[model samples]
Target: MRFSLWQPGRLLSKKNVKGWVRLTLGDMGGFRNMKSKWAGKTWGTLGDSITAANGYQPLVQDALGFSRVHNYGVGGCPMTAGGERDYGATTHVGRSIENTLDCVTIFAGVNDFRLDKPLGAIGTLDPCTFYGAYASLIEDILVKNPLCRLNLWTPLHRDKDGYDIHYVNAAGYRLCDYAEAVAALGRIYALPVLDLYAQSGLNKLTLSNFTTDGLHPNEAGHRRIADMAISFLRGL
Candidate 1:
């Protein structure tokens, strides 16, 4: 079932939607495709509770043999920038800004979308908005670590009693909106994107086996995440 419930009335018009459906993001013009060998590269991850749980990172590192791994994830964090101790991506990302990690993978947007934080206009680099926060974060990483490779991972499928992939938050946006934003940023930045939301294969049927409480992944789920991440990082 397809849902078109964009906020502020027609965020994506029928024509725009058709065009979007027709466009292949990976093949879009001007995308450099951030695919490179990841073995032995120093890695950094920034995200929220699921990441803070320390589930999949170790698995990924062990499989890929990362020389070093820095976990900057904090529980209940959002991608949008905010005050100190707010666990925002911009804030957490600073932990490794000076390290110039060889590779950085960001898995965020769930908290932002779930909290209904403002998703700034596309192409905007302001920190107050979701898209802007991401754009700003990416720009900072690239500027600071000129040789750093980056990847963006979309939020995984949600399956709470009152929430699912199609659930639209109070901000008049669904989970896919945030996922698409990650893809849009990937296209704009010419970076690789591991579309976990669409590709995680986590859904109602698999939630119990893959997740602990419908939102966070369990050991098995983390392994699944590692499996997919391993492939994605290797191919990149």
Candidate 2:
């Protein structure tokens, strides 16, 4: 379904009572073919997944054919590592994605692995640390809906331009390492892991495909992400 931020009142309209689901970085509404009794559920996106150029709403509608979507991706969320010591426990897994659906796709960690900030520097994520959390997320979904499916995607290689002073140091940890970690966890839980980072050389995309900030993707980047996601889903 087509949705716009302009109609906040429509959120409660009977026609849109599925409840809203929010993403940390982008808008919602990609599950056109997938419907939920919890559609329009109140959601609190807590990462940097959404931006002005590529909101999740349109992508969701285009990809999944959902009529409505909610987004809450913050610009600087750390996927593998938690934020400040006090805020570390506030990652997406604990906040919203857990309760949003029977099936969930998690795309994070790049911000946490940022190479610029000394604190955000890349570090090895003990599989033990993330594995449990990842399992818990899947288990939580299954506990609520046993037939649910979880899709976990790993981070892509940093774009060639990503090595600049502003970008993370490419020398730190390889994006593949993180993807492997996610994939490993998926194996443990028997969940489906979509290694789009490996399937698509997103890092090689031209600057025109990226946002002016040189980090996030522009419309082209979002499209690439959507296309890849659709292809992956179709393969299943």
Candidate 3:
């Protein structure tokens, strides 16, 4: 079924054929354009972020020679399942309670990072709280589908200026703190982590070229992420 996407008898090139798969899964990733008030002002979503496309799912499919992919990313959503805003409950647009995925990549925390909440110690607080939210979500996934491989993904580096505008911590914690928390969780759970924040060569100066608004990645950035994810999934 996967090889049908790259038939020599067909007219399209292999790259174009693969691109079609990307486009199809892109929408399934829940790329949203939305704005709402949070603290008495309008806040906008990272409408063009490609975390799903650049995530392990599609890249693994492509590298493993499969043409189709399943993406469960929900735009503008945090991993806080039963916490504060309770976004996770309704944000699971693609993942089903019964369906079993071959692999589940935990690539949330961007919105939480943007929220700039102080990091918490893992497994010590309510599972619905900031860091605990991730643990709760992971536990649920594993409990529901124990056979599926699980991976943790850190969000890519954000522009220094962008971070300053969107994030703040009284204790001087920065975006890297969130990434570190994610890596720490991966260590506790013994799950493989793709630290895009430290690994991806995106910085304040070069972020504009890779990202659309110094936050959401552009096509070039997505390509870089896809390359990294393909390598990661292949290794697994």
Candidate 4:
């Protein structure tokens, strides 16, 4: 039961295969086991600034040992386009959703909240409306990649709409409401939901420690996100 990545004599040779994996992966525990799970698979990420930033992707790649983790995230992109808000050039629906990737991680909603995008009903078919956007996106993904697995990550804590997660945005819906909607949709699709909102240990009070602008995650924050994503995907 030896991994093609590590062996007895090849403890730390940087130029060698084992060393390459070690150098790239660092000292994460259970690396071999976790790495094996995603070793040959490809991944795609979809989201706003947090997902757009030069953060988390490499860490996720190193930790999970995935073959590829492409970023389809656009910074100001919202899940919902809703006719009122002009998205200009970027939208969350990118090549990632249309292609055949082994997995996809969607981490949107913050922009919609910050932009005060309206929250349409749960089954709405309109990609312009929040709920409708998700429904359309999920349906399309299912059709595009029948074997591809997906995970929905709720937006992290931020005061973009309001400092408190319970604070209502201009649209009059709380941040937590959006998070719940994502979780609800995950259930409908029978997919996994990684609730960073409830699990990331980040809040308005501790913004300085984790995020850069109280919205996008910094290096340390990206590591935390990568760790969580790696753990969640491994379990799945």
Scored by TM-score, the top model is 4
- Candidate 3 lDDT for residue 27: 42
- TM-scores, all candidates, are 0.80, 0.60, 0.67, 0.81
Question: What digit string (tens of lDDT, one per residue) describes model 4 on residues 1-236?
Answer: 23235567665445654435432333444557364678868998888878878599888787677787787777776888655444521234643454689988888887777777777898776777778888777777878787888889998988543445766778998788889899999988899999999999888787778988787788889988988988899888
- The pairs that clash in candidate 1 are 35-236, 36-236
lDDT (CA) per prediction: 0.80, 0.49, 0.58, 0.77
**Against the true structure, what is every candidate's RMSD?**
16.5, 11.8, 12.1, 6.3
Worst 10 residues of 3 by lDDT: 36-45
True-vs-predicted CA distance for residue 39, candidate 1, Å = 3.8
List ranges where model 4 is wrong by over 4 Å. Answer: 1-35, 83-92, 95-98, 160-164
* Pairs in steric clash, model 4: 82-128
How do the residues 1-236 of candidate 1 rate in per-residue lDDT, one tens digit apiece?
Answer: 34343657556666666644333543442222223355557988888988888899988876677768888887877888774535556434654555568888888988887777778799897887888888888887888887887899999998875778778888889989999999999999999999989888898889899998999999999999999998898887
Candidate 3 lDDT over 33-113, as tens digits, reads 111111121111111135434443343343444333445555555654444545443124323544455655667666666
Better of 3 and 4 by TM-score: 4
lDDT tens readout by residue for model 2, 1-236: 45533365554444564555434323443343445443443222233443223454365445554334335455544543343532332133444443544345566545444532122212322322344434454555566656544567766555434442234344354545555766776776777777856775555445445444555676766676667766665454
* Candidate 1 worst ten-residue window by lDDT: 27-36
Q: Could you arrange the candidates by TM-score from highest to lowest?
A: 4, 1, 3, 2
